[model samples]
Target: MYMNKSHSRIISMVALVATIFVMLFSVAYSSGHVNHHCNDSADCPICSMLAQCESSLKSLGTGLIAAVFYAVVLSQIFTVSLDYKYQSVQTTLVSQKVRLDS
Candidate 1:
């Protein structure tokens, strides 16, 4: 069961990376091969590719924003949880069961 989950996670991570690469490549390719003399025709290949690149970039931007938001939220949650846990079992004389000599 654990192995199956791990495999899925790895596959998902690879897929996400591949998607990022494809989006970047599309944008780069479109920019490098921009159609300077576009006649606003319906059959313009470069224009179509550029449109797709723009769409991909927008989706990537949205994903980035959500990822950042989630990362910040998760960091704060883990920080609070860890701080509370440490405080509960913090090292002190009472916590260590020290006996007074007096």
Candidate 2:
């Protein structure tokens, strides 16, 4: 579990890069428009319903993407913190062992 300071730094940098990539991707995808075609018939209940449904789905999709992006970022952070803590504990244990042996 113990990782050198350099290794930890590398892992952090990678995580940062991944976070940025995901954010950019999500933004690009969300900003793209969705094309829906409906007839121009007066009193067409189907067209009205379809438009409402399309709007609702688009909103839902955006919300889902945002949620997923946040989740990925948070999980990466949590993993890095856990790894750092584990490394610290291992280093402490090794130092203690060395002193005891001496």
Candidate 3:
């Protein structure tokens, strides 16, 4: 689907902000130290697995957020450039028409 210049800019800004907020929250949540008390051998694997899972999830979340942020910014840039190009062409066309009508 295609969106107009203003609409696309707003959407991109909102997405970028949302992604940054999520990234910050995830980083903070993952940085906090968790103390796990394991009494038996069987419990040790569970605790280790849980930690590993959390770490993996944090890494994945960070990567995904970064990707989204970059994508949004790039798209915004592309849209703005397109709009500028379009306006320039329109102005040139109008000037040529005025000259011909004179």
Q: Pick the lDDT winner.
A: 1
Name model 3 segments beyond 4 Å from true.
Answer: 1-37, 40-43, 86-102
User: Candidate 2 on 16-100: residue-level lDDT in tens?
Assistant: 7975666555444444423434577356655555555556556667977999999999999998988874344455666766556
Alpha carbon lDDT of residue 85, candidate 3? 44
Q: TM-score of model 2 relative to the true fold?
A: 0.45
For candidate 1, the per-residue lDDT at 99 reads 98
C-alpha lDDT of residue 60 in model 3: 69
Candidate 1 residue lDDT tens string, 40-80: 74798877777788888888889989999999999999989
lDDT of each: 0.83, 0.67, 0.71
| Candidate 3 pairs with clashing backbones | none
lDDT of 1: 0.83
Ranking by lDDT: 1, 3, 2
Say which prediction, candidate 1 or candidate 2, comes out ahead on lDDT: 1
Q: Per-residue lDDT for 52 in model 2?
A: 56
After superposing candidate 1 on the true structure, give the runs of residues whose Cα lies further than 4 Å from its correct spot: 1-3, 85-102
Off by over 4 Å in 2: 1-39, 86-102
